[model samples]
Target: MTATLASVPVRSRSFAFILGSPRSGGNTETLARYAAEGLPPDSTSGWLNLCDLPLPAQPAGPVPSGAEKVLLDATLESTDIVVASPLHWYSVSAATKLYLDYWARWIALPDVSFRERMRGKNLWAVTAYARGDDRDTEPLTGMLRRTADYLAMEWRGALLARAHRPGDLEADPAILSRAAGFFDPRD
Candidate 1:
């Protein structure tokens, strides 16, 4: 079921899908949605489109009280954070970078306790690249791994898929099958 970041009550398992693609319904977003299907029936999932959430690139100071604050709230409230972005130059999209950059500022807020609160939470990624060896995605994955390690968050791995066109993922059964189990908890 669809849930909003603000509407997601403090609960057991809530996920926040932060879409970083400039366009909607792209391969990366589709993969994330498919992965969300693997969540338990009672789990709640929220979608936050980074394209719609404009973050200023000013003198680089404290976190603003607008969309950034909303994003911060969503990040803190969710048990798992899914960063969905199309591979850009073997790394995350600019929008995704902007969103992640705010974490540093938030961590220094003193009152937010952002780093401590992020500990134990899950960090996952869903990304699609047009062409390249599978290993080419290492830069993106490695960055995420480092982010998780720094925050003491659990590295939940990633759902990496190959898709060139917009609807390529929708037609790929193998990728679909992989996404079906992407979120299944490992024992």
Candidate 2:
């Protein structure tokens, strides 16, 4: 029940991609990269693998430091935010969920208009799953839309692909076409 990616007019925009899966070089990462293919190198902020960073102590605890902070900084400056995660129990991975949990901290950071900064920015969800119930993607998409709504950001729909294993996307012509056409500016 994942929503089809809207055929909106494409315009070059800075994007910071967050890889939510813990497995390095996995299909989720590959799919996210593919979805971003239309964005030029300079327009893309590059991918940040959350699995490589330390998780915050608690949801209400202080924000993460070092690499996580750098990721946050990049996100703060980006025009769009893309969250790429593998389906775990019908939802995003622990890494992606925890990273999002930290947003509460940003919303409360004193002297920093973090939430305000996020306002008006576009939020996109990208994920891949196995041959299981693709219907599982529905709840996750709802969660993303709600999150974006709460943050006052625009919900830009999602690019969902089914890949049982790494490199499987190579055979998904529909997904490949969707990803390839994502950034092409149309009249």
Candidate 3:
């Protein structure tokens, strides 16, 4: 007798992560955790660990692969999104860049526009850099801003932090405080 595998239904959550870096104990993960702390308990959140997912290179045709569609769908369904990343060569990590490239597929879909799906969605960025210089984050911030604008998502400010070494963010009180403000904005 052959047994068929059962497909578990995926949960429809209100929040999700578009994580850029795959490394653990990095600034990106730290920042994501901080931002998540402020979210209401009832809201469901999913972390799309970029390292675990197999995102192929950009396709040549108009239709995006099934994998790309799933990713876009997950983000579109979320009410609040946090794009977490660490600075790589003064810009976002390659993993995050690949994911963002897939957005073009969503834009090409007829009757379901990328702008419409992302409209009114609250979007925030969290970037970690090794340098204390605040300007080091300009490239990443600018890229994120442009991407958010293209997607028609609302820009909800960014949380930037500096860490000299791995796990250094834990010792930075200023970063922690800034993170708190980003997650729970008083104004």
Candidate 4:
């Protein structure tokens, strides 16, 4: 039998939801939250809204900024990192891009050992797009998959939803239902 997310003990796993949506409580966030519902009640879930904590366009070289440190700490502490970013212009939002850019700085910091630490961590994505098919979200997915490969992190897959309006996802029972077991460990 396959072990599910809920079957895993709390101490062995933690989740970090990095919300990169421009607005809070959007479709992508909702989808990710639905998937998170499958976790055990005692699980540690760190919800970081990129909209609230924006990353500066410029990196502070090797020294991390306050916001960066907050994000960095969460990233390092999690066993799973769910990037909940809406598909903007067929890709991730600006805030999400900036956050990913910081990874380069983190890798070059000499003392941070960011890449080494990220190894074996699970990387998941939740993205919603309008006016297109699955191919539209492929670029975003590819980027994330490549990132996971580069870091030696496990590519745990993605939750892609089609949402044009603010509440489109909430109205879609099928997508929401799929989300319920999105994190169930697959063989």
Kindly report which residue pairs in candidate 1 clash with one another. Answer: none
What stretches of model 4 exceed 4 Å from their correct place?
1-11, 40-42, 185-187
> Each prediction's Cα lDDT score?
0.89, 0.80, 0.76, 0.88
Q: Tell me the tens digit of each residue's lDDT in model 2 across 27-113.
A: 888877777777755575667888776566563345546866777787898888999988888889988888888787777878558
- The runs of at least 3 residues in candidate 3 whose Cα sits more than 4 Å from the true structure, single-residue gaps closed, are 1-13, 60-66, 185-187
Candidates' TM-scores? 0.90, 0.85, 0.82, 0.90
Better of 1 and 4 by lDDT: 1
Please provide the root mean square deviation of candidate 1 (C-alpha atoms, Å): 6.5
Residue 155 CA error for candidate 2 (Å)? 0.7
Of the two candidates 1 and 2, the one with more favorable TM-score, higher being better, is 1
Q: What's model 4's overall lDDT? A: 0.88
Q: 75-122, model 4: which lDDT tens digit per residue?
A: 989989999999998889989989899888889888889999999999
Q: What local lDDT score does residue 187 receive in model 4, on the 0 to 100 scale?
A: 19
Supply the TM-score for candidate 1: 0.90
Candidate 1, 87-183: lDDT as tens digits: 9999999999989998988888888999999999999999999998679899999999999999999999989999999778888999999999998
Candidate 4 clashing pairs, residues 3+ apart or interchain: none
